[model samples]
Target chain A: MKKILLLAGTALALAAGTMTASAQEKLKACWVYVGPIGDFGYSYQHDQGRLQVEKELGDKVETAYLENVSEGPDAERAIERFAREGCKIVFTTSFGFMDPTIKVAKKYPDVKFEHATGFKKADNVAIYNARFYEGRYVIGQIAAKESKAGLAGYIVSFPIPEVVMGINAFMLGAQSVNPDFKVKIVWVNTWFDPGKEADAAKALFDQGADIIVQHTDSTAPLQIAEERGLKGFGQSSDMIKFAPKAQMTSIVDDWGPYYVKRVQAMLDGTWSSTDTWEGMKEGAVVLPPFANMSDETKKLAEETYAKIKSGEFHPFTGPIFDQAGAEKYPAGAVVPDGDLLGMLWYVKGVDDKLPQ
Target chain B: MLEAIILTVITAATPLLLAAIGELVVERSGVLNLGVEGMMVMGAVAGFAITVSTGSPLLGIVAGLVAGLAVSLIFGFVTLTLVANQVASGLALTLFGLGLSGLLGEGFVGTPGIKLPSLSIPGLTDIPYVGRILFGQDILVYVSFALVLAVSWFLFRTRGGLVLRAVGDNHVSAHALGYKVIRVRYLAVMFGGACAGLGGAYLSIAYTPLWVENMTAGRGWIALALVVFSSWLPSRLVIGAYLFGAVTILQLHAQPLGLGVPSQFLSMLPYLATVVVLVAISGNRRATRFNTPACLGAPFVPDR
Candidate 1:
């Protein structure tokens, strides 16, 4: 795309101008946050990674981040600016940055590039993402235990792979708990609108969704859960304060260790292109502090987590049914990568349909 | 079913109606400003920052208005005086506003937002049909209805309205007739910018009450479309905005009722409808006749 070319040109200009041969070898890593780091959601979690790199890598690694970079020509400019900073390693954190990352990677072939939640990979560029579906599936199990009507609510941002993956995982986990569990969904079609995100949560709450989740990057749903005295999970970090009593647990993204390791590898000459899909097993995905759980609920949660981490159980196991009750997944079989990435429909346990 | 939808419509329409009404006034005065998104974002950041600092939501709303006005004045000066391209300048304003807002609002994005207390009227709030839908909302929702009526009256029934309309239709005629066309448009642009800011403040201080990047989303564009969909008539804008609100709320409902459609598809409905209606109503020759000013989106050259 033209956007990709412009980004590459900008990176080339910046890198050409900003590079200086200093006495000490400095590993500069730049991060592009799609949302503000303050939003305890997507960008916030990534910012944590930057902080981790600072602590773990110490003086050898230097971290610089730019927030609220939307996907467009504007983002290309930001990428150019980061590249110009002589960043040896840059992480563009969003699916929309897929092409721009590749383009920039081409320009700065020496620079190690890591993109989150993308499929493209090259000698100079790498792709990485957490098993977010694993987290959702775990929460789904908790929702099944808590809800009397076995209903879960989701405030999804779009029909993209990320959102679709979460929906299916939640259904899989919830129904595994209570076979009749159903999830109701609302899509605001935006990644970060607090107003719509809250409204979506409230609407679902009104429909008696005792356990709620959101695919958008905001704390609105968690806050609403606290206000209404219902259990819920946090997005990127621990949101225990939002719903102290109601929050069973939260899905936390721990990117700091990974970021530090990547920077260290670049310094030690061990860095290479990789497509990492980390999960709870690798400690890339984490659970927030459990709040006010009953003895039985706590046991149920711990047991489920153990099974997931140990690979004794998976939420994507088959004999799963689609909305039409067609056998989408067979017993003892895992959902394939193709179906999971292009997930366009809901599982049988979810009442909602995938939008056109 | 209708009650919930109508209430949802009112809430959804309030912010759009407020911003659209302001844009209508600005466009009528011959200043085509496309920085509504920027102004709204400025308002959101300013409003949220002030609210957190002062602990008073009212002051936050005022700060948002002033901030929005300041952003608009910049656009007005560049377009009205320097004769820059209105479209490019406006989009530039939005990009700048977004950057500025993100920098300023970085601290408040994911934290728990300030809680607004809902106002309760004695007997009216307790009334059977009206109690739950109309009277139970926060102060901003009620204020939005009043604003719609007031804007409608000001645009169609006041002396200032006539002057504004004259300036938009033909700045030369208004200038020859001894009216300060440029000054009037400038003032109108500032006022409109303030309203857009206030609408954005409402999102942070009242509606959602949390600061987030691009929190206004495309609501400002939707508001701009509503101006045309309303035929630049304030009353019709009210109807259109609420209809959008209802559609937005209805979207969340259909999925749970087993409508058998994906929520993502449902989410696209409002935007799709906006484009479809824009094409339909805008295509009507008679309606299009009075829709645009003679100098719409054109820079005014005082000497040329």
Candidate 2:
């Protein structure tokens, strides 16, 4: 009996040792998405980033993802589950996941958490975002040059600083070309709802706004533009296929490079909590090839893109005035990044009032 | 501008009308299936997939209707045949349908869909404001109106409709009277599934012409509420759907008008209207009870 017990103990020890050795062989990185990857918009682009991580670091890492995770108690549970599952890194991709990410990070201090488009962070939780407003400025210029009515319809999702910043940058760009250019803004208050987006597009078009700009993540508005023989810009992914004749250009979110770099940091034992806000210069926010626009307009858009990329132009340059005609920034003084990140007030020339 | 607003309103209202009319029938037969959203989403994915593969929106519509009916059979089997709890079974059906549709629609995501062409009558469709409103709609819009009228006529004017309602009101009594309660419910549930599917297909093939997961986006739940809001009456269902759709669209228009009202408040108008209307309707206890199915959400088990 004593001899048999010794043999069994030896076997169990060997099995446990092999499990630890295998666990050390590769790092596990996980992601929590707010919307389904099939959205082909915001969530789709983020999943592309995850796929890139897997492709670039094939043997060194194992990746997992939970799509369509709602941003509330559900997000916290998802993040906690990944942490408990021995994930070396967790990426929560939504602004609404900010507090939840922070909450989970506290419980799992060793797990590195990366959150997108959120402000709050902890010692173990890092925050990162893309300067989507940069591309919005370029689209704004295109809208100004292309719009025959000098009026553009803007379809927006929420009243977050991110969306508000995009609206301001667009207004600034439009005003640069046509000083009196106007935009009619409609807030549908959702990140994605194709039907509502379509309805908003129709409402804007009916109100005499010939050009459409959407901050929401769907191709529905662009499809509406194609149906009406009008033009608009695409969001998140290149939606040219959905609206071949209507898409002037698209603001594509490319998070693959940054994702690869961070995962590499984890493997190299150099991972730390850091805030990152990358833009066109880093290839984080890109605009696809211009189409359905005049050469002159395309050239103008390209120039704006190059300037923003080279840091030669800032969309929020001063001499800026709020909608109430109050000067927010003096001439020759650019709006600081801090102000832009938390911007709530609308720039002058925006047709609608900001929802407080 | 008026014509344009009216056109947008019609598109918005059509899907809700289609889904609600079907649920109205299901509830009238004493079965409250909360799986309308699931069935609708399944229809959307199936219709979009078929349309993409065949390059024919007509076939896509048919596929959606068939897919919806097919999914409803699962519900019918569990609740009617297996004698499972109807509420629990219906909710499970929704979750299952959503997950299954996502898996099925994996390849079709990000692909563009062919639009269902609207009916265009040369001389008749171009008449100033009213012409386009009445004659320029897609085939589904007309179909929705006709379905409502037909359902109204069937429920109020046909012997079959009376029997179905009797089954819903009191299954024991219905069975005692030699009516096949379980069989009547199966047919009613299948019809509901098909209509919900058609509504979902309209979304993918016509309204937005794309398929995304959860694309129905709680429209199914709205349809369920609309059934109650309409007091299970077909004509009132139409009014309730249009009212909901109109408020949804008009609120978007109202946003840019700078009325000093917050956009959030405008967004809330539709839900608020639903609650107000519901309260007003429920105040009339006689009317509410008269239309509500007595055996709704109750499972039936036949005696040997």
Candidate 3:
């Protein structure tokens, strides 16, 4: 009887310990945004992903976010605060947050860090970016089919590889429809400025562009296009409400599934650092229902989108030429991911000089 | 293309001209309020919010002006009444304004705005090159020009203007002469705030016709630089503002116009031009001595 009582006590103590451990397994997640959540653009979309994590995990995970956190030193502090606050996983959502995330990850090696639209990675830091160029290519097809002047104007923030890839993909998609299609680029060197973006749009409109494509985060370009009865594509989030008549389609960023999956991995103790670049196939970049287009154009856009998803159509398929008419890619060959990731030159039909 | 470019240049220049002209008067009265950026952003948010709610750009402009004035009064009380350091106070004002505007403008983001219509002068507006510029501008454009002319005439010609300038040139002497130095400074600061507010309203209503955080994009700083670049002269302020505007607009067209230089260099045109012009203007010591307010950025204490 004495032996049996001792064994029962040991079993009870072990079960109690297991229960306490499970209770402490509740995970804390944090996100750092580069702009105010009300931007209704880039930051807004990222915030939605944070919400998705909460919804998916319910009581198992708690999430928080710090908005309008500028890049550089400020970002490092914000990330560190999350780590110090007992957050197990932190996601820094902006390309500029790359180094800051890495720096903070080094100090808090146990904290898992996920950065978006960045290339750098460490043991504790995982980089993820959506193939936004894929969405740009789809929109470019729609713009080409519907453009009255066969001229599209692109308003970009910087000449980074990501932005350059979007421009090249857009032009390539347009060229597939109209071989003589041309694109004029105006670099604003800012991510969000409604006034400047609007001005750029008007300037491009005055220069005879009927379709405007923007890599910057603002509804101003599309709104300006709506005001002038022109068409454009939205960036970061769906902006159809802001420009119902003008938005042909928007490159809606769906970071929800990815965020939920990452949190799940962390919870299961199977988290590992890796780089993820998912496009339409992985559902990172989604397109809204086609609008401001004819039935035929919409059908064609759908078909092209499916082809991209199925790996049948690639935007950077060779024979590609640089702006200077030099062949960069040979015929019947698709550009490799390594080369596309570091693209800096504009395609042949782009009239702007690549700023070194 | 030339017509379009000119139109864009005008739109860009008007806000800078308005803000600079206001700061010019404030400096002429012997006070340096570095809160132009702060006040302008306040105007932007207040203007955008009122316009979005009321659906009237006119009321929005008024709210912007009043909002800017309200913010400037805080600076006025701090620097003029509390005798705080002008430079530090102004910097604090900018930080405050940016933060406050971001908070206030949270709800106004992404909302479509009503564009203030341009003034159509019938037949005169139809004339090709010079017509749209001189006759077909918006009401605020004319207001900006009128303010410049009015300020120029007021500063150089009127007795009141002389008293104001006297206060700026030498506050102690002006106080000895019973010129009400603090009162004059207060009015000058308020006027500067109102002008900056108008410039901000012009940005949200007429410039972009929409609201976004940090939409001023350092235009207020550029305006401040223009005041110094123009040697505090209202007429020169116009030249500097337009030149800056022209450079900004032309940079966008450089590549299309077949200029083979990199876009980054083109992007730096306005700022680089400002530095070059400032250096050239500073080289002439006589001009600087003649125009810079003797009491600029200096604290004044009136002894009863």
Compute fnat per model.
0.54, 0.83, 0.46
lDDT of candidate 3 at residue B300, scale 0 to 100: 91
Per residue, candidate 1 scores C-alpha lDDT tens digits across A1-356 of: 01111212232232111222232466778888776676667888898888887777756766667666677666677776788778888899989888888887788788888999889999989888988888888788777887776787888877787788888888878777788777777777777777677777778877877788888777677777777788677777787655566678888889887887788888889999998888899899998755666677678888888898998987788888887989877788888876777787777866665666
Off by over 4 Å in 2: A1-24
lDDT of 3 by residue, B115-154 (tens): 8888888899999888997888888898999999999999
Q: Report, for candidate 2, the interface RMSD.
A: 6.0
Error of 2 at A122 (Å): 2.5
lDDT: worst 10-residue window of model 3 chain A:
A12-21
> Considering summed lDDT, which 10 consecutive residues are worst modelled in model 2 chain B?
B94-103
Q: What is the C-alpha RMSD of each candidate to the true structure, in Å?
A: 4.6, 6.2, 8.7
- TM-score of model 3's chain A: 0.91
- What TM-score results for chain B when candidate 2 is compared with the true chain B? 0.99
Candidate that scores best on DockQ: 2
Query: Which is better, 2 or 3, measured by DockQ?
Result: 2
| Model 3: DockQ score | 0.24
Model 2, residue A312: distance off in Å is 1.6
DockQ of every predicted complex = 0.41, 0.52, 0.24
Show pairs that collide, candidate 2.
none
Write the residue-wise lDDT of candidate 2 on A284-336 in tens digits. Answer: 99999999999999999999999999999888889999988999999889888
Which residue pairs clash in candidate 3?
none
Best by lDDT: 2
C-alpha displacement of A36 in model 2, angstroms?
0.5
